[model samples]
Target: MTPDTTAPTLALLLVDLQNAYFEAPALAGVRESLIERANELVRAARAAGRPVVLVRTEHARDRSTWTINMRADGEGFAFRGTEQAAYVSTLERAGAIDVVKTRDDAFHGTRLREVLSGLGVSQLLIGGVSTHSCVAETAMAAFAHDYRVAIAGEAVASENGSLAAAMLDFLTEELRQPVLDHAASLRLLQGPLDAR
Candidate 1:
């Protein structure tokens, strides 16, 4: 069959692939490989002239935007103007758009949905850190917004390996989203914008 011209364009949505997410030893081991995969997708998307959104979690230093856990524990992470809030330095982000978020769901309080809409993106290829939280939340929200979503399984990492797998399962089996590997994700990125 031919491509579905009615299908909206695809964009790469990377979630919370930041310095703080990789500092933990459990996730540190996969840092380099995740970066490698993310950078590859970034490059491919850039070369293809597709949108690449680098989403990060950033909270106010005064705990103004802190979630309940942060407020209860009297602590915060990815504070504004701090290195923790920054994206991982090695990822290819020169021309990509930046979407800063304070919640697990990237679209909760951010302009992520608008940003993607402005770019004419309705299909998302996602790869990010902490599979059970930010990544999962954003993917689910995207689905709710009627965006077709896919997770690049190999390009993501999590502090809890089992939870990560379970979330992937939920995204795939229950939500009916595809959890793809690196090669499959790359093919989707490089293929026709209207193809499914």
Candidate 2:
């Protein structure tokens, strides 16, 4: 389908592109190329006048919840307000809605739904790190909430490529959401949000 150029009030949802995820030794093979692609998407979203939402993963100083269910090697990795929790430098911090999430899903216990609802945003464009976990969960949650969801495939990454591919495929085919490449997402943002 062609992109709508009517300036659809889209919201760019950046999930967990923080410093910790990038520097973690456990995530060694994740290509730096994904960060570049995600930055491009952020640029396009801003140029198109869409609202950008940066979701950061933060854990309490105690790190009780984050440590649970995590591998011992990656335990206590995302402490709140630490350098590890900050957004990457390549992405612009100004003019973006910044929110802190304690869990995998950004919407849980956060003002995300309220913020988007207040903005009258009917569609959500999502991209970020850990495609199989936080990113995938957020995309599906948006769709389930009845918002049109689009995920930039190239703008997301995981510890492994196979898991990323599987999550993208499931979201596109089973969930029936649009899993576009970075270029396609940019084109869509340029067009009207109402365009199919």
Candidate 3:
């Protein structure tokens, strides 16, 4: 697909790859593989000098930021100051920038937009957990912001397999956001962009 913009900077945005979601009962089967794929992309991005933005979700202990489902579910998901909200050890990199968001959309109440702007980023390579939720939301927001957005399919997962598949397809077919495999995502993250 042709790029939507000519802005010079590009970044790998890893959304909500925290321990809380991985340790969930429903996501056990695919968590490790997803993390591995994400790590591959992260390593490539780091080696290539592209910024790796770790966008995570952490809510108040009182559940002030949680949706009704999250409040009712009570798995202590992404609660602030808890280990669950923390990034997986392997996925956390020293030089990566971290942004904590309280909602599904990372840019909603966070400095993500400003950070990207500061870095002159006009394209975002997105990946990570709960494909049908935060991943999709962040991708949509990024696209709405006019950033060229591509999601790393292999690097993202969801508790609901069927919904996750549908979400990816929807993002690609309906939303015009490309769902890329690990290698293609790597090339995008590591390769040079067209001269601005």
Mind giving the per-residue lDDT tens digits that candidate 2 earns over 1-196? 3333454557888899888888755454554676677777778878878888999888876656564566455667677767887877776667888988877788888989888777677788898878888998888888888888888877777886688788888999988878887779888777755533
* Per-candidate RMSD, Å: 3.8, 4.7, 4.0
TM-score of each: 0.93, 0.86, 0.89
| Number of the top-ranking candidate, with TM-score as the measure | 1
lDDT of 3: 0.83
Residue-wise lDDT of candidate 1 within 1-196, one digit each (tens)?
3433453489899999888888899888888888999999988888777889999988888889999999999988888889988888898889889999889999998988778767678789988988999899899999999989999888888998888889999999987889998889888888876744
Candidates 2 and 3, the one with greater lDDT: 3
The whole-model lDDT of each prediction reads 0.87, 0.78, 0.83
Minimal lDDT window, size 10, model 1: 1-10
- Which is the winner by lDDT between candidate 1 and candidate 3? 1
Q: Per-residue lDDT for 1-196 in model 3, tens only?
A: 3433444478899988888888778777777778888888988888777878999999887777877777789844677878988888777567889999988899998999988887778878899888999999999898899988889978888888898888888889987889888889888878975543
lDDT of 3 at 41: 90
Ranked candidates, highest TM-score first: 1, 3, 2
User: Which is the better candidate, 1 or 2, if ranked by TM-score?
Assistant: 1
Off by over 4 Å in 2: 1-8, 25-32, 64-67, 70-74, 193-196
Residue 1 Cα positional deviation in candidate 3, in Å, after optimal superposition: 30
Could you give me the TM-score of model 2 versus the true structure? 0.86
